[model samples]
Target: MGMAMTSSPQPPPPPRRRRSRLQSATTISAPSANPKPNPKAKVIPLLSDVGRLQSATPTPTPNGNPSPNPKGKVLPLLSDVGSNPSAIDYYSRVASNLAGAGRLGDFLIAAEGLRAASGDAGFAARINWRLLSRGVVAALREHGLPHVLEFLRDADRIGVHATVMLDADASDAVAAACRQLLDERIMAEFVEAIEALARFFVKGIVDPMDVLKIFVRKRDPDMAIRYARIFPHSQLLLCNTMEAFGKRKELKHALKVFGALKDQLGGINMFACRSIIDICSHCGSSVQARIIFEGLLAEKITPNTHVFNSLMNANAHSMSYNFSVYKHMQEIWCPS
Candidate 1:
């Protein structure tokens, strides 16, 4: 009976684990055929690891407070940047590294993180905002104008100085906006674009005069006034925008601009009076020209010889009116 049991093939010896002289408590074993993931393994996320961040549920701390990160350093939620210096550097470096790696999408994530991190505290002042802006502008060049506009809004929300973006590429941004308008002819898009450019003007990146010209060329006096009003100190801009309409033979637009300016307490200077008179002369509205001259007197605006000449030209079709203008000139400007 004992020999039969021995011949029955002793149950396969329990799998042997060969020992090595080098083996120690710290020694790592080769992965099994189906090794389970290590729960304690450390995972260092890249700066651009947006998914991991967004999906990370706040872990409870020893004090029962939920923390965004484990090291007792609480990070702000996405889109809400806080003042953590290390967090700022983490995002900025990730952006730069991804940019250098030619990973545009990842770079974008890092850029957003950097911008968000800059919003709450003085972090914006500490980092190179210009460099961050440049990276975004470069990466989105292939994208559309809507994306550009969205970026501007994001920057604004993040407390980035408007000047920071303007300095990055003012002319290029303007040209891109204009090019989009030319392609689509969407007035809404054009308005949005002008709004963006107006930010540049407010920051002093673009000349206000150029902006005025752009609005006047669109022939929408209302839109022109709307934007011009954004700059409370744009009296000269209003007058010049009004005068430009005269050259376009848009008498009504000029009149509207003049009325809006007057309503805003924009002192009607001699330049504005002359511009309106010229417009009346072009449109052959001698009656309107006469009304403006009288109003100038009421406002105590000094009328010069140049005004009399323009008044006379305005009344070219009316001999009596022309004689009256001459008499006025003699009484005020050319008494000799």
Candidate 2:
């Protein structure tokens, strides 16, 4: 028991550790196996990194108000573009070509930078018939009519100007295209355009009947006549053509177009009414002309002095004119 007690006491508080210099050096030199991750770790997200993410991360809504990014910095906008040689070089070439060609629209489309640069909406609405015509004429002078025609085929109004611009030799193509449109039922869109083109082809203002003749020969007569009425200045052309047809004894065609013209004009013109009379007289359909004259008298459009003179002249030849036109004219006249 005495020995045990002495041995236990001999262990005495193992000398209060004064860290050995070697131990301290070892601790300082050795790397720890269970090291802690850095607080400023790359695992933390950046604002740009957050922005670049799509659909994976939920956007923050803190109390319905999101926290702002902690690491954001403003970046300069397009600062490097000025120094980009390729971009500048490309634009320089395009600009020179545009200037030489007087094609500012094309130049802008091909420029270094622009949004909404290409397509019909960008350039189509900006042009008018006259300016477009001048440009087309220049292109034809430089290139040829075929190229201009090809360009116009894309837009109906442009097609019209092209029609006028094309030489008569190209009429086969123009008429063929127009006929194709008629077949496809798209001619309504192209009708006025075609008429304008026809006027250009015929030189000077085209008679409405002439346009009708072109339209009717290829498409429906009623459809052509209807479209002719819509054209500005078509009335005089229709009226004159009707008169000329009557003189040439082309009775059936004259009467057919005349009736259509009458309806289009609301059947109210004294000029149209007189043409009917003359057509009937020459075709021996004076009876029909007489019927129309009586209807006009009933409508209170009394024969004018000039109309009466023509009536008197007609009557001098035979009772046919006298029995019809003169009788109608004399009834409306207050004897001088």
Candidate 3:
């Protein structure tokens, strides 16, 4: 039984794997004092050489991937874009892409970069700013002036005004965007419009007057003056605001605003007169405004077109129409 129980001979050991030449070659080792070059490796031109040779060979895309269409359409690198590379078309596409993606703020910044890059005389002459502005305005219209206002504030938060040209052509571009918002039948809230314009002064990117002029043209001067009251001591600003209230025939509120003016030295006498006249201009059959105008004349304040206009307006609905005032105005102007 013991002899039968003896274990069978042990299985033969597995053969050792032979080291493939590829594995042997790849082993890390210190270099020889004079290393021999590998026959498999090929020498290629450096990166600088690639740029120089791209015209003859295939160039990479704007994204820096190897060109699939080397012989096909070659996109000019942003650096080499000044000449014959469809730079305008390329940027236009880029602009539209960003806007479509809702990166309206970035589109403006990109536009600035493009303009700056092309600022070199070589590229400047070819850029049609108006054409480019079409894209800029489109994005602006889509994203809205509120976004642009916020963008301007964000730029200031990061101290970008010194570097960015929001005060220059960029400023005009943004202002145009604001104008676009006006034509929209669905207007933003009165408070929103005020806050947006106020941001301009917070960073001084746009002239407040520019916006006011727009509202005046649209016959919405009151809306603009409502914005003016947000400024410090804005008597001059409130001057128009009060007058606007009056144009709505809100005489009481208009008088209240006029009284609030801190004209201690009477320096704003001309403004005071004009404001009262304008406020009464539309207030049919109002003697208060005329009384004020006469009192101003008694104080020797020069009566300008505004003064006469207000006088005519106050008398418009009464027996004393503009014609009589017109004759009186001529008498005041023309020497006897």
Candidate 4:
């Protein structure tokens, strides 16, 4: 095999063409001597035609293109797209499609068309509160809290205060959602949202205490009580609310409040004193509350058996320097 091995011959190269001196001296010309300027070329009008057109035509946006009909045209932009068949019919056809697709940024151009058409006259009337609320709700669910809040503020600046508050008509559903979040302890966010709504809907006229009561009725009684304290005028309601606490074995609250009120008044009705004595007897603690009863009597009120019984029941076990006080109490009740 080594003896028969031989190198293969190389193939010949093709001959190169040579140019003459005169031909070499001549230069190549451009594709066209008089090139037509682009028919749709953009010329900077010191004031932007785009800017000028911006006032009238729906400016083509990026997310989705806008329409090009004369009614919705960017005159220069329209000519540009029409000049090239391949270019988007952005001004003519694409704008409507974009708005149809719910691309708000794109549809804003169409909105421009609409705003321009009505000269913003029918805007306030046509874009009603119901529609506005629906839009806001959609924006909130679709975008987020900040977005909705921003819209709410803007609407308020314009006069949508009534509408925003009226949305409480949807409170049942909204409140249910808030409750679930509260239970999960994810309330910070929802609380802010609700607070924003409260600020918008009930800002000046609403009593914070009243609002808290509503929440208490719906969500937290203790919190409601604390908030209720902020409203000094809630005394009447709070007094009546004691029965509710008593039913729940929270009589301490009722007694403490009523007792404090009695003490603060410095003098109360004999019937009122008797009622306190009865409460003390029921709780087996008239002696602990004796100072109040004594103070009432010192003010010329008569102490009854109910009052005497209250003292004995609460003080019987304790050693008293005046065992005579007990004798007097017994005789007072069964005086012979």
For 225-282, candidate 2 gives per-residue lDDT tens digits of 5565665666776666566666666666677767777777775776776676777677
The collision pairs in model 4 are 66-95, 67-91, 67-92, 67-95, 68-91, 68-92
Q: What tens-digit string does per-residue lDDT give for candidate 3 at 76-186? A: 444544454586556545644553455646554644555555554233233343434453455456766566566556544443331133334545656555445544533
lDDT of 1 by residue, 1-336 (tens): 455544455687898897775785348776579878776776546764444565546878899998676443344333444545566665555555554443445655556566655654444454454555564556456666566566556555655443453443744664665556645656556656667756644443345566667767888888778767767566777888888998888889999998888888756666677888989999878889999988887877768767767887888879987887677657665466
Query: Against the true structure, whose lDDT is highest?
Result: 1
Query: If both were scored by TM-score, which would come out higher, candidate 1 or candidate 3?
Result: 1
lDDT (C-alpha, whole model) for all candidates? 0.66, 0.51, 0.55, 0.47
Give the alpha carbon lDDT tens digit for every residue of 82-179 in model 4: 34433222332333334234332443343344334334323333333444344445544576555655555554554334234435533333444445
Worst 10 residues of 2 by lDDT: 112-121
Runs of candidate 1 with Cα error greater than 4 angstroms are 1-31, 34-42, 45-88, 91-122, 125-143, 162-174, 201-219, 226-244, 261-265, 316-336
In candidate 3, which residue ranges exceed 4 Å CA deviation? 1-75, 84-88, 120-145, 148-224, 227-252, 256-291, 302-336
What 10-residue stretch in candidate 1 is worst by lDDT? 72-81
Report the Cα lDDT for candidate 2: 0.51
Q: Model 2: runs farther than 4 Å from truth?
A: 1-193, 196-231, 309-336
Instruction: Output the better candidate (1/3) by lDDT.
Output: 1
Report the Cα lDDT for residue 5, model 4: 75
- lDDT for 115 (candidate 3): 54
